[model samples]
Target: MAVGVPELKIERVRQNYLANLVAAIACFLLEAGWYSAFMDTWINGIGRNRQWLENTGINPAIQYGTALVMASIMATAISCVTQLTGKQTALRGIKVGALLWAGFELTTLATEYIFEVRPISLFLVNAGYWFFGMTLMGAIVGGWKKKV
Candidate 1:
């Protein structure tokens, strides 16, 4: 609509809510495994752990609910991106997901951690999850709609 962009028709679909839910669950489970495997180092780095969260009176429901919400948002966003780019297939989605991880997730998280003086290990752990998780989500969502 402006600048070097050309006008094009944007097709709208129901957006596949079921696919989004599946992707969300997949990513959430992946996150859980990732954190669990690295919990010792991760918790020491943050000086926090499961007991800390519980002692603070944080509800497990809140944590899970937040994860679901975030995963759903990621799924929907990837779907839109795939549709806009005319990208089909899980492989294509993986590429898009990588680019997004590099451009958006990596950049933002790195910047925040740098300022906070957090260790690079922490950043690597978190960013590594996003890197793989985003690609996995893209693969699932990409396979859902082969074409825009």
Candidate 2:
């Protein structure tokens, strides 16, 4: 992102909210695919298997809602940063995404895995998803800066 963007405005932030929302959803979907594709590996890493997951039940509503909200917040934060940095471009978004991924996603997962003695594969899968997801998020939020 640039370092000399125009002054921020409420209207502009509001306009970008939609873009952030959409990006978040896309990122979330990417996450779902990533996990699904590597489901067996992930489950095994966490000391589980297909049979366990099939029997274990989670609150779908809470899970989906939490995921959605997390994605939305991430996208919105990226969008805001893109504007503040004065680099409201897809490329800038990618840069921001990488930063966010490293700063937040990678760090968090690494810590969790380290403490839990989780598999490297699990970390790889989770980290990879955030890296790509954040970059794509930046691309979408930064690319769609026309309105803002």
Candidate 3:
């Protein structure tokens, strides 16, 4: 404890692991669909083509594993925030997800896009996916409370 800083007491928020797992799986699936739908646009945005992508030698497992892990982290964060803010509910989770997306994800991506001079279409594709994905995760985490 630093001088003049009051001790902070944080409540233990019980998390539903099942909800987090389900939420992460849902987001992972959403990522697959979203990318598939915007495949051409996304590839073109990065100035690449199918041949280039295939030749990149990146393992699909690594890509998918990363996505799932990220989704899980996001789900847990949403759950924690939702519980901390107020009663955890599907509606509240949705709101938190949207707010977090706009506040953190959107802002950070916008900065990167501006500096990298990336296409607006690419930004929309990526950002749009997160918007929906986060909300979905939030809804699950918020609506499914861990039994105390």
Candidate 4:
């Protein structure tokens, strides 16, 4: 309708909530296992131990809930980007996941680690978990498309 401007066609993206939920849960569980595996190194890297952690008075529910919520958000974002960019597939999702981690999560953590003088081991422990977790979630959500 405009003189030299083309009409913008907005396409609707159908989100698979089930896939997202599954991805989030998977991410959360991966976190648990990752941390458990690196518990000693993590505690040491933070300059604390089991005793300090137990005495921190942080509620387990809050911590777990936060992780779940964050994972859900990340999974949804990956799915959205995967769908918007091109044909949605497990490989695309995985690539998107890794790229997002490198672009956002890894960079952010690297800055914090540098400024806070945190150990590389700790960074690896935390960042590695996210890399794997996000990729796994991406694969799930990307592959599980909503029926048209």
Global lDDT scores for all candidate models: 0.85, 0.85, 0.94, 0.93
Best by lDDT: 3
Q: Please identify which of the two predictions, 2 or 4, would achieve the higher lDDT against the true structure.
A: 4
Comparing 1 with 4 on lDDT, the higher-scoring candidate is 4
Query: What tens digits encode model 4's per-residue C-alpha lDDT throughout 25-96?
Result: 999999889999999999999999899999989999999999899889889999999998889999999999
Cα deviation of 31, candidate 1, in Å: 0.7
* Backbone clashes in model 4, listed as residue pairs: none
TM-score of each: 0.88, 0.84, 0.92, 0.93
Query: Over the stretch 109-147, how does candidate 3's per-residue lDDT look in tens digits?
Result: 999999999999999999999999999999999999777
Candidate 1 structure quality by residue, lDDT tens digits, 1-148: 5899988876764477888889899999999999999888788778788798569877889999999999999988887787667746788777788889999999999999999999888898999999999999888888886344
Off by over 4 Å in 3: 1-9
Ranking by TM-score: 4, 3, 1, 2
Off by over 4 Å in 2: 1-15, 146-148
Root-mean-square deviation of every model = 3.2, 5.2, 2.9, 1.6
Residue pairs with clashing backbones, model 3: none
lDDT by residue for model 2 (66-98), tens: 999988988988887777777588989888889
